[model samples]
Target chain A: MPSPALRVLTDFKRWATPLPVWSGRLHAADWPLTARHIRTQGGRLLAFWGEDRRAEESAYLVHAAFLIATGIVRTEMVVDPATAVYPSLTSIFPNALRMERALYDLLGIRATGTHDTRPWLRHAAWPADRFPLRTDFPGTDLDVAADRGYAFPPTNSPDLHEIPVGPIHAGIIEPGHFRFQVLGEEILRLEERFGYAHKGVERLFRGLDGAAGARLAGRISGDSTVAYAWSYAQAVEQVAAARVPERAQWLRALCLERERLANHLGDLGAIGNDAGLAFALTQFQALKEEFLRENQRYFGHRYLMDRILPGGVAFDLAATDIAALHGAGRALETAIGHLQEILAEHGGLRDRVVQVGVVSPERAAYLGLMGVAGRASGQAWDLRVQFPPSPYDRLQVRMAVAMDGDVAARMAVRFQEISESLRLQEEILRKLPDGHPYHPLDLREAAGEGIGWVEGWRGEVFFWLRMAQGNIRHCRPQDPSWTLWPVLEEAVLRDIVADFPLINKSFNLSYSGHDL
Target chain B: MYRILREVLRLGKVGEKPPRTQRDPASASPSCFRHSLGIRHVDAGSCNGCELELNALNGPHYNLEQAGFRFTASPRHADVLTVSGPVTRHMAAALQDCHTAMPAPRRVIAIGDCACDGGVFQGSYAVVGKVAAVLPVDLQISGCPPDPDALLRGLLRISGEQVNS
Candidate 1:
């Protein structure tokens, strides 16, 4: 029973023959060694290639790695002035195809030995030659008319019928196109084409100063606002060596848990609603409203956006607020217990969800899934438990896990997580340290790269912030949606197209988060 | 009839319902709203604030379907075009085409601060500022991403339903 981090690190240390030393700065020389290090660390190879941005003199090769045991991630970049193409990781990791193609399309980075070079993320709307992420590229001129119709993969057989669900869905959900190839009721293949909501979030953060950058991060995905803000703050804070007060850390955890609880409650309710259980929807909606109202009463925003800043939290919780939070937590616990009882007794709801949209434990492990979706499938990789950056470490958070890998399993994980979050929130409120919520960090302009990992309601949210001369050079906000979206496709296999919504809702991966 | 009576008896005492008159009027519309919106949402390259708020609109607080605002599966069937994010280059055409596909008398609601006016990503290289830059927006709900309540109000306004406030 070694700690998850230690187990992962130890396995990785053995996997790679030549170990690489920790470099003070993420420079060009460290790329190869880092890649080797990641491979030895039981990490699934994702992609490796150079990106030539005309704005910078030196070109760089970006490498993505997904660690298996702990779901820890490492991305390496090396500055290579020479035009040397690296071999593709597709042979080693089949899933690297989509990511490699996306990198190629967005950054004009070429990957040698890569089998597929089809355009992804770059629709016909943008000039085929122009790469938007590069600074030197002129902005897209909207005045010109371009072909808007997308040619999806065509299925000729009568058995292979296509079901185009949305870019606009029946429910009030964000837009994304899901084209299902079904054989009668069972789905044979599911292809998702999104960017209907593509808002170049990464490129938007390129030039903003740290303070302004944090605000943009908070809005990355509204439900995960606290998680994104904290991750962005963690990156900046680490780069600046800024120390957040213990109380601020505790308060950050409280906010994160509240966000987690709020989302889980809503998700549980929505999952039920999707299953045609109106009673569950009404009950859960009422609970969720009360949950959000409590958030508004304490934090100015119901979603807790902008509550977290670079140095510390934007606002401090008063004693009265803490008392109110505790009271709310108790009430939530009672309500959740009652809801669980009802869910258990309702055989109709149980039958609909149980064994529906099953993602086997093996597949979940292979995909490197994270968050509640991964946990439900028995991959208990939680950043709070593994990384535990300060308050979580002190609080001793325990992750909730289930092995069924189905819609019901996902719901159970949500229920258990809500309960766990309530307990954690109470603990945080009870032992909150007394001090200023923020301590201004007199951060200087220096080039540094730091990784911020936070267990958002959607699993692990990873942020990579690179700063040069007091301004952000690059920011990568990786949501678990990147991993889970594919899993949703796999889970829907053998299920009818009509049941897709129920299955999809159970794994609620964020389209905007992925599009970013 | 006997089975129906037995089923009613099994459902223990129903909790006190909120006063019928005092209940939020916005929550009383037919539940079929999700079937009607024929919604086509476009992201004009936002900081993602509007998108989050858009997500909140679907969540528990103000379930949009309860009020007759549903998201459609395609632009051809949509009655309203909901655009969020500051209009960006990658999405400009899709945004326009989605609007064009919808039949006449369709309403366009810009749901977030970014969609209303680029909000934080106002002057970014990738952003085209506001949704108005590319399309005719009928309603604007302003908040970095408006709260779920504010989003609900904006949708209600578009549906020709009066807001209680």
Candidate 2:
């Protein structure tokens, strides 16, 4: 409610951005202690990643970025190659468990004293000893046998039976495995296993220049291409010390808001369809199609991929384009209003959605739930409002919140967000700045680490990039789905197995993004 | 219900005509699939860009069902398996198993550039190359992610349709 305290004036060095970002180095011994200090001060672990810097230094570096009351605080710790282990923050932030496991799986950097030691990203695609992210290792596909010995933790209830779904779902969706422990119809426990869609995005970004890296980042998650691309560009620009033009910033905001609107429309329809309303799917899909068509007309890509390059946007809006957007926005606003009324009035849909798969605020906080799903559970954290970067700061965005923490609440948030995005788009178009869309970034002399934070349609999309001699050294793109997936597991507890589709659709976490 | 019905009536006949087949005539198809075709889509390891286009085929705009093509829930009921994304090593086995589950004389269509080749992630350690690397691909529709119209055209071509939009 209150504006974040001016800034955390600690020992951390602040980045050269209006957004509050403070970076601090931590001793290996104080890894867990520093994490506890942040946790005690009510900080949320935003992202945790490991970088292999053995060539530059003997030790592997583990970085944890946290969102405290003030702003983002990124802390780095060096892990000795001999030990190859650091203190785990799983107890402090439950979501860090998967990240720490992924760190070990990718870079052979283990997080000691963690409850779960199971592999997260490594599904026996490569040897256990061979870490792909290491400088010495080459990125080559091996014809090895798949990991068939994945052990799902027992819920300690012998009476409950297990039902495993996916890796290949009935619907046309991304791949992920879900194991559910159920008694009759009620689900007791649900464990999700992803990485089936992992295409080694981080490895692919290793040697790419700014242009190529931006393209790869866009593909990290197709649905959130605009967000990923923008965030990647922002990070690259920050590292290159390139200032994007005012018009470019506003245009980027337009692409992001449009992306948010399109996704919300699509998800709202799917959620309604999952609740037994087929009409909603058809109507919403049509609306979403129209929205995307406009994007193609103006931005040149249906999903706005490759539109946000390193320095600025790929395409600029013409007079006709601006007029067309205004027309489309009005039509969309009317359609969305009608759909909202229909959804609100539909009793059967309401009965199916309301109070189903409830993730209480306490449970949400404990699991570090974030993004649209988090806001529904009373996590009043929207990056657009809290730490607005450029155009978002100018937009004065409204944060959407709900307390029920149910499927209805998530749906409500989506609808409200759609309205807000439409409003934002109208404002962006009305006060469209006049300048070149691109600034022509020359990364020949660029050599530094920078962080990019964008409030994507789903939630906050964070990118951490380190450039060395104009090429990407280490890049980490963290999707909000990382935290929300576990929250889905918690939300499904005690709910009927049949309602899983509806609840999951409401959350709508990305498989490729999470897996990557 | 009344509101929905009224809304549907108001937006009447919005479906577009089926796009013409881009497939070569030499690629023969079984006569039984001439009238109707059932497809099962397997996302081996895609960015979900192709999946979005494929999903758009079912919307009111494209409405592939009117052209006698439908997405089946089970592989057993499918005559075509539409695969997307470069096949990840993790999903390679599942993809093969899915192909194995389909009935005889089933065609495999790889949608998007990623499914055709590896696209951007061609040489990644996690990837197992394209759909053809894992399964016998009959058709490869190329694009970063083929548009819905292209996706529909690909489906109809495999089903032996030469219809025009």
Candidate 3:
């Protein structure tokens, strides 16, 4: 299915579209049976599913085109007031089962149609039937035993062995649980049970106003702080119909591109390091540190958190900052050039990454993978280039894509993307609009719903927010990881168990992004 | 000779010792012994902020390996415990088991604002909420998730290292 942003753009191009062309906020009632529809030249459908009380009343939005165009995207929400049982979308999209069951467990919402309603995120630690996310759920007392009652599925076969790795891993990394069922060295099945690090981030937005909510949003994922904050701000602005200053929009794009470059560089280095290529790690690490230090010098936080506010950006780039960025760009170019030369000389590195984890184009399409991973697999659906919003439209963007569908392809896409980002950054610095960084937005407590779509480094970040009585009625930030995580599972199917790390790193799907 | 050249190129001039402030042996507390931390990371449901920064530490730039700290696969072999997230009901037991499995002289370093005081998940129904509620915490590094540098500093502090010196 074409992404929601594309669906919106297509709908905008249609003459017979019933909806007003430029309406920023759409009433929930006016939406189609699917909850929302944008009529463009090819028209697309947006559907909303359910809402959490912490954020908003129950609502689900889906892109019309995503359903009709592909006929693969199926979603359902069962809101049973008595048992609070929500219909499951797993039967249609097997991937949604975990999230749906998790929602059921957390929100006291049950998914009746789900096949495995196993305690996904929920274990025996909490009292049975006492849903934690419910409004009245009491906090747990410290008297609880750490291992009082928890059981993992056992594999008792003579040939088949179970390997339990982590809640803590060998590298300096986030903790997660991976239970690998293997026959001889071949992994038969892999079950990932996370939420060992559940932080209840979504519930944090309970009583926060727009500004306070934005701060919370930035913390949702630290590396993607700029993207989350910008996306949250975009959703809030869209709901309030607030117009961001042109300069702010441009700066947001610049920061996002920089974020993309920094992450890509780090990932590129790590991918090589994982494969025993120490040279790439050192080179990329140095480059990444330099990049982040520049960001810290310009913005308060190295990660650029709280820099992109709701109405506009918090900090404006002075001419000197722009000049410094240009200088940094030149340095990056030189470093990347040297690294590329080294990479070219080392053919062994190429062999390992080229076809190591191949997620065929066909599978990529079926899974609806987006972002660089999608681009690597021949799906070049970039929000910046295809659906240029504001400053992006004025400043052209050329997406980088590769059709190899392998680790090398993903790497190539990142390499190309860094060059493209540099070019775009230079253009933005040169043509930065002459104006104030922000304009005060007067947001009212009226009921309205808006979808904010931004191209985060990972992929398209979709935020569907509804405001009621001056509070966030509902806010759902859909990370592209939701779609890509399953793709990683699919990609690992035929590959060796030893190669899992390389494949997993290639995707780097955000577990936190998906859990929330 | 080639190996030396490669090492020199890989280390570059940036390896000239992380300024004296960052490298002083005195900066490490006399009592601060290098301890193997067995970290139990909870999702408690986050946006992945803490994880990303944590991930960054493993990446080349931060190169956490340089600190003599390594992430172990099992809690049984760990000395210090690191917890992320606001402590959700789902992960509460897992967090505790991880803590219980660790050997003595263990300290818990709560990384991120959420882990510190339910930073964002302050009053959510789904949250159990703060890391302190489930376990005793020795240090709190705040931010939505503290920066990797801050996280490293917190780890050093928990290990009884003198950080700023």
Highest-lDDT candidate: 2
Candidate structures ordered by TM-score, highest first: 2, 1, 3
Give the Å error, residue A257, model 1.
0.6
Quality of candidate 2 docking, DockQ = 0.75
Q: Interface root mean square deviation for model 2, in Å? A: 1.3
> Per-residue lDDT of A1-516 in model 1, one digit per residue for the tens?
223433343333221101111222234444344444545565644223233433565665474645544444444455443653454555555556667677766677766777567776666545667776666768754332432466777898976788886554555566677889989888999988765555667778886788888888987777788999998998888778677888888889989999998888878888888888876766676677677778788888778888898888888888899888888889879878877877767788888899999988888877767788889999877777866777887788878899999999999999888989999998988989999889987665746766677889988787877788777877778777776777887899888877888999899888777776
**Per-residue lDDT tens digits of candidate 2, residues A3-104?**
233123225778887567888887877777777777777778999999988888888999989887878888888899988989999988888989989889
Off by over 4 Å in 2: A1-10, A138-141, A155-158, B20-25, B163-165
Residue-wise C-alpha lDDT for candidate 3, range A1-516, written one tens digit per residue: 434653453232221111112222223222332322322222222223345443244432222113233221223232435556544445444446666666655666666655676766555546667765566667564223333334566777878888887655655555567777777677777777765545455555655677787887776666677788887887788667777888998899888988898889988888888778887777787788778788889866677888988889999888898899899898788678767667756677887787878888877765566788999999878877776777788777888888989998888888889988888888989999989988876765645666666788988776666677657755666677766766775676556778778877887777666666
Q: DockQ winner among the candidates?
A: 2
The stretch of ten residues in a row with the least summed lDDT in candidate 3 chain A is A15-24
**What is the C-alpha lDDT profile of model 1 across B45-98, one tens digit per residue?**
554556555655554445456565666667777677888777765667667877
Which of the CAPRI classes, incorrect, acceptable, medium or high, describes model 3?
Answer: acceptable
Find the number of clashing residue pairs for candidate 3. Answer: 50
What's the C-alpha lDDT at position A202 in model 1? 71
Docking class of 2: medium
